[model samples]
Target: MKGRSVILGQINGLEAAALMVDGQLEDLLIDSSGFAPLPPGAICRAKLGRQMKGQGGVFVDLPEGQTGFLREGKGLRPGDTVICQVAGGAEPGKALPVSLRVLFKSRYAIVTPGAPGLNISRRIRDEETRDGLQALADMVMEGSDMGLILRSACEGTEDGEIVEDIAAMRDLAEAVMADLDGAPELLVDAPTPHEEAWREWAEPAPDEVIEGDFATHGVLDAIEALASPRVDLPGSGYMMIEPTRALVAVDVNTGNDTSPAAALKANIIAARELPRQLRLRGLGGQITIDFAPMPKRDRQALEQQLRAAIKGETETSLAGWTPLGNFEMQRKRDRVARAMLIGGTE
Candidate 1:
């Protein structure tokens, strides 16, 4: 397999990074300057602000006017201050203050307080693998109150590494708890998206890292191609992606190759490429994919393969096809729209 490349650029004056695999953009990671710098996995002290009626989550007011979402905290009243960890980041007008869950993310595991037990990644379906990780967790987490979630990255991690990671998180948790008396304080900042991306994929080793600036406009222009409505597939066919005020419509065209076999191949390739486009563009919300007419069996098979490719994506889902033969889907809206990012809008 060809190694990936990392491209860095400026989108709306915020630093951004894009990971490209085999000449195609895999994901575009961007950081905006509008929000306070809170790195993921960092615990912080926050106070409950006014409860927004009809909202599923409560607003947590941190120091310096920073806000957070207490998605699952119970018995919280307005003006009540508590400690919260930065679970996710803030987007322009959406996902602000970041979703503040009390979960601490480590390299090999997630330490969640009050849930005292060990849980393995559901992707590790093999009973033997799950049991092995459970044994390892039990050995290292002796007498610890926090529960551990063994991440997929811990599949083959050494015993010492797991031990060290848990130890570091424990110490960090202890320090945060020690200073809980201070209200509206930031105990820790979350890791930047670029840092997390580098730590995860840089070791597989990228061929090059491109930085985007006024001097590197060519790179940004190339990256912007991913946001285009029409894209040609590798061997044959093409895809037209149209976004409206409601849902995103993706129409697949087999082009000159009309044979059933050729169409199937093209649809499969398009199915694989579509998710990459969504990630690179940060396009989310309801999505409709129209495949070139294929047999029902082949369409079902294609859906399976597509779902497997996007399995871990919490926001995106293949909701099956419509009566009119189009595939219906939904992806949670997360980042700023692609047009805004490409145009460098403020």
Candidate 2:
């Protein structure tokens, strides 16, 4: 498949990544200049500053005003600032590339392995009310600065892990506090890509897995260890997946087939593969798949064949094709698809 390529880097304290799909500039990933110099576990405040137009709270601005989202809540007024951390660099023109948190410190860290919407945060508040509980609740209710969010690494983690993470954050916070006037650096560790994927898949099970051509054996081995069967596709047809401002498109073609029926068969095979692709690739929102046209007699048979192939593959519901020969469907968007595809574990 032919597509552009780009480099991801931190440019002037902002999270910036360049894209060149198909050898063309597809997009550029950029976060706030205020969010420059991102460090793992470092929490920064995002405010609706005077230069910005939207109401204050947590504002995730996108290029060309596409895929931008604003979240407002108590303690997040037009002028009030909310705490956020650079979860990681997001793809260009994507919404909320950076993850935001209401509280800095949490008690229990929630982790979702390999699942897109998987979130990791510390739980600060407890329902059970007692002397210490009341104090902790008050701190959470008041939004104290001492709290820090524990990431997905804390899932099924022993108390020792939580304590160690908290201690690390405390020490880092102390250093920042001590050097109030100087540039401070805090080192926060993020989970490995494999660990993150494990967490997501652990959340919602996958029936089978298809490994990418470029994926490393170690990566595949790690995923396979999680109990999902893996299969490598035959090197015949090729696919190009592009995520645009409007929707995501998957184009398929018989790159090497010579038979007349080969294209139709390949199209049918590709269509059948869509559901699994959507799950494994996490392709959400409106998705369009353009494949080589099939013969009129084969159309319905191909549709049924694809449907049967993808039955019960994911949470997404697939509809039959329209009269125009277009198959339409929607996938849930709990988290960003690029995060999953590009291999990020948070």
Candidate 3:
């Protein structure tokens, strides 16, 4: 219950999936139902709708009445049509958007049609590896208009494979563009959460495993796990997460342990799990964590650990501990919650 978990389910002809960590469902996955599948990274034709006054982005009407926003209008008007890709899911409470900037991703590389340049993943730290990958990317994109971002997985891959990957993506881009006039619908679906998680991490942690009886489980089972905000810790503590209009509140309690050491232990556990919980639930806006009270030095250590735990998140920030020893954090929500995605939000 303290590592990763994967689940796939279907209900009412809608297929859904999820990824969980430490018994908390973190990422939600859903398949497109009608018209055509509008998966991320698939390019399609879209017509511009009315632009929001004072807002930089413009809304567009996607097939099937779903609304998508373009952060930059690129001079497109209400009636003008343009090609766009399903860039990503919408932020919590916002409609999904498409991007004029299209990217095709392989295991080792990300090929961009709009922005042509050589880039490397920031996660790759070794200078020599970065240089090698950059050089390889540059070589592959030598005369092509497409840009390439070399992922960490490309570090040890041969030049031939990398080149072939880039070329394959370029070909896919051409095919998508070519079919735009006749179909003008979604081209392909992005990898599901399960696929993305496995591909990026190579493998889940040793303890990670698929949950539920796959043969009998329904989508509701997965949805329920993701919708709830309460999670119990390994030994004798539990966390309750409640979201208010202004902020998300998380309270940690030492359920059965009363010793001084027990308090510290439970607090540390809560600190480690809190960030994962935030990510799993996709709760955003302001966040406040209330843990069992402890000394200043211990609290400081816990804060440092929490900071280290959430370092990978670009949109999440941790403010220093408050006077009352609580922690405050802010995370930008950019994906719909599972409950809302399934029309089960209350």
Give the candidate number with the greatest lDDT.
1
Q: How close is candidate 1 to the true structure, as a TM-score?
A: 0.71
In candidate 2, what are the lDDT values of residues 89-111, reduced to their tens digit? 33454444334442233333332
Alpha-carbon TM-score of each model against the true structure? 0.71, 0.39, 0.68
Tens digits of per-residue lDDT, candidate 3, 141-250, equal 77877777877776666878877877777677667655545424556566654555555553333354454443342325545555677778889898888877578899
Comparing 1 with 3 on TM-score, the higher-scoring candidate is 1
Q: Can you write out model 1's per-residue Cα lDDT over 126-244, one digit (the tens) per residue?
A: 78878888888887778877788887776666877877887787777667765767668777765565665664554346787766562343446556575568989987699998877
Off by over 4 Å in 1: 4-23, 34-44, 49-55, 59-75, 82-100, 119-136, 151-161, 177-185, 202-222, 242-247, 256-266, 292-299, 322-325, 332-346
Residue 36, candidate 1: C-alpha displacement in angstroms: 7.4
Give candidate 3 regions above 4 Å deviation. 1-43, 54-56, 73-76, 85-94, 98-101, 122-132, 174-184, 193-198, 203-227, 243-248, 256-267, 282-303, 318-336, 340-346
- Evaluate model 2: give its lDDT: 0.43
Q: Candidate 3 overall Cα lDDT vs. reference? A: 0.67
Which residues of candidate 2, in runs, are more than 4 Å off?
1-44, 49-68, 71-76, 84-237, 243-245, 254-268, 271-286, 294-323, 328-346
lDDT of each structure?
0.70, 0.43, 0.67
Per-residue lDDT for 140 in model 1? 73
Candidate 1: count of backbone clashes, pairs at least 3 residues apart or interchain: 7
Return the TM-score for candidate 2, rounded to 2 decimals.
Answer: 0.39
